[model samples]
Target: MPAFPNSCFQISVLLLGLAAGPGLLGCARVVSATTSAAAADCLVYVGTNVASEQENTIYLYRLQAATGTLTRLDAQPGGAAPTYLTMDAARRHLYAVSETQTFRGAASGGVSAFAVDKKTGHLTLLNQQPSGGGAPCYISLDRSEKNVLVANYVGGNVSLLPVQADGRLAPAASVHQHEGRGPHPNQTSPHAHCILPDPSNQFAFAVDLGTDNVYGYRLNAKEHQLAPAAAPAFTAAPGAGPRHLTFHPDGRYAYLINELNSTITALQYQDRQYEKGPAAFTELQTVSMLPAGFTGPNSCADVHVSPDGRFVYGSNRGHNSLAVFAINPGDGRLTLVQHVSTQGQTPRNFALDPSGQLLLVANQNSNNIFTYRVDQGTGKLTPTGHSVEVPSPMFLQVVSDFTR
Candidate 1:
């Protein structure tokens, strides 16, 4: 009998959930966080997606901050393709987008709300409301937590949904449509990928991948509405599909990940109240998220700044790595720090724990999640040598209990 090729062997091991050597393939197992004397308890919520309409569930796990171990806690029935999730500031509620084109007989997706059970880390379905668009891909809470903003990838629009007092979602109070296109083949129409408020909470920005535009809006928290800003849009380079945006904690800088071009653009933000609007943004520098000379198909997914605002991290899908960069304190420029393997395939999303000591990555295609220990002085990630197996884990949200 002929021996299997190395690539085939690795694929077979991954599919069979067999143990494999380090740096080659991840082993499958049901592991949880164990308690240690110095452990801080953290609740991790993972959203999953599958190819079909088969009901997928959102999983809850208990994370031991000291050990970086994850133990399964509970599972809630998340509707079809709950691909993205966001938690409120109080950690009392969780919101996720059911990424489907049809919802309750309407040609729109849905956003579901869940009440977080503090004791058991369980989630109870609060309610779900029509997201006012089709294929809602991203969801986020405004700075004031009074409204939820959703980006519709297929509908080419963004919507603001009012949050009820009981942590439920109301119908969209305002919907804004994006119009334009980019040079990429995927940019045949507008695709609003993500929307969130700036650090000042006075202006919200929507990154549209299909249009290569970052649109700004005046956030009216009182009325739970969004209006176009004076500086309505900042256009990125043509064919550079901006997927997500993250602001520096200092509120002086913003980072955008371009999915089509595999690059990150750093911009300086001004929050001075002008007569027309309250914010302005100017591009500082654009940097590549991949190493030189290794040309492979890659798409950038998520971009996030460390809690201390000293580092920036972005996810690479085809490259299956996390690119880390150090922020220059003087000018808010980025210096490449490291590119570490995500230990699995297609790391579509990741999150940094509140303490900033741990980073969790969701390997969407490999059906697993991995943890890394972060170095504070240098923005480097060291694998914790720990992983947990879940089916099609697409997003991760960590709610930390630092008091523990």
Candidate 2:
């Protein structure tokens, strides 16, 4: 860690709004001490999409850990419609999906790689590869972080790319096309929404909005492949349109957010014989994401579990709110806790800081981002009174407890 200058210390104080508080008593030492100890700053990355290609960018913001105040740091031009992002476990590199229908004259989207600057928290483009599909919507690293997985909406396929040692990317090593459709008009064709590796890293799952199914894959990390598991597809309710799936910290249960029906289903995960036997998911309970009598058009976008595994959070686009649910430890059932407004429109994506103390939301239609304080005991959220104007903010990813 490097020593922060007096000016840097002063700016940090201003950003944190602690000019005359007990926390500032050590301001003099902040200039000479390590940056992390002095400011407790974290880095937040915002991905945006606009009509103009030049306006698509990945913006970096610094989060004051104590106050949850976000200060703009820098921005870099990302390729077309960089809507989703993920960082490696080492925090040395980041990957984003260019959500476009065509890349380099081919009928496929692109996955871009960037190196993370430790000191400035800036990103520099390393290389890009075809996502092996069109209109890629989500990108995530496998548990090993040695491979990148992508879900393409228009192409209805999932792709795997090998991560090079230098943080660059290689072309797709494998691509699996989904086959099916649903009852909804939006589900006329298969749409792969997101692919996430299980905590164990031995298995991965992809949720399809069009097919209303969650497909399982056996991760072949050494060979850089995603082989379909013995039981490949877990069917959801007709017209449910399952979009995103998140596993609990204990890995015994998984939650599926259905985009079309505005409901979340809790499922018990049973990996019988590891890689040899098929992974099974038995639906436990299904609950509505919207409040009673609020029968308006709404869609589900994202779902995440609390770091402590005590709560589940899901986003509703038309409802413009976050639905919080408490998890029953014994049976892995969900009980509705609260429905809090995101303070803006179209809550497309939200992320909890690494410390699990702050929740940041990106309101796409309103073009703003809002922060809320998390209550560890109650698993509820309260507005932090900190908001920033970001043009068409689509997704937010926080690198909590960041030094730079």
Candidate 1, residues 1-404: lDDT per residue as tens digits? 12111110000000011122344322232222321112234678899998775678999887776667888978878987898898876568889999999999999999999887655667788999999889999888887789999999999999999999999999999998888898899999999999987765666789999999888776777799888754444678999999998888777788889999999999887555322343356788999999887599999999888877799999999999999999998988999999999999999889887657678999999999999988777879999988999999988877654212
Q: List the residue pairs that clash in candidate 2.
A: none
Instruction: Score every model by TM-score.
Output: 0.88, 0.89
> What TM-score would you give candidate 1 relative to the actual structure?
0.88
* Window of ten residues with lowest summed lDDT in model 2: 7-16
lDDT of 2 by residue, 1-404 (tens): 12111110000000011121353222122121112323334678898898666438999997765676888989889888898998875568989999998999999999999998866768899999999999999998886678999999999999999999898999999899998799999999999999988766766788999998888776777799887654454789999999988888777888999999999999988765333344358889999999999988999988988776899999999999999999999999999999999999998889886656678899999999999878777888999899999988988877643342
Sliding window of 10 residues with minimal summed lDDT for model 1: 8-17
Positional deviation of residue 203's Cα in model 1 after best superposition, in angstroms: 1.1
Clashing pairs in 1: 32-70, 32-71, 33-70, 33-71
Q: For model 2, state the Cα shift of residue 240 in Å.
A: 0.4
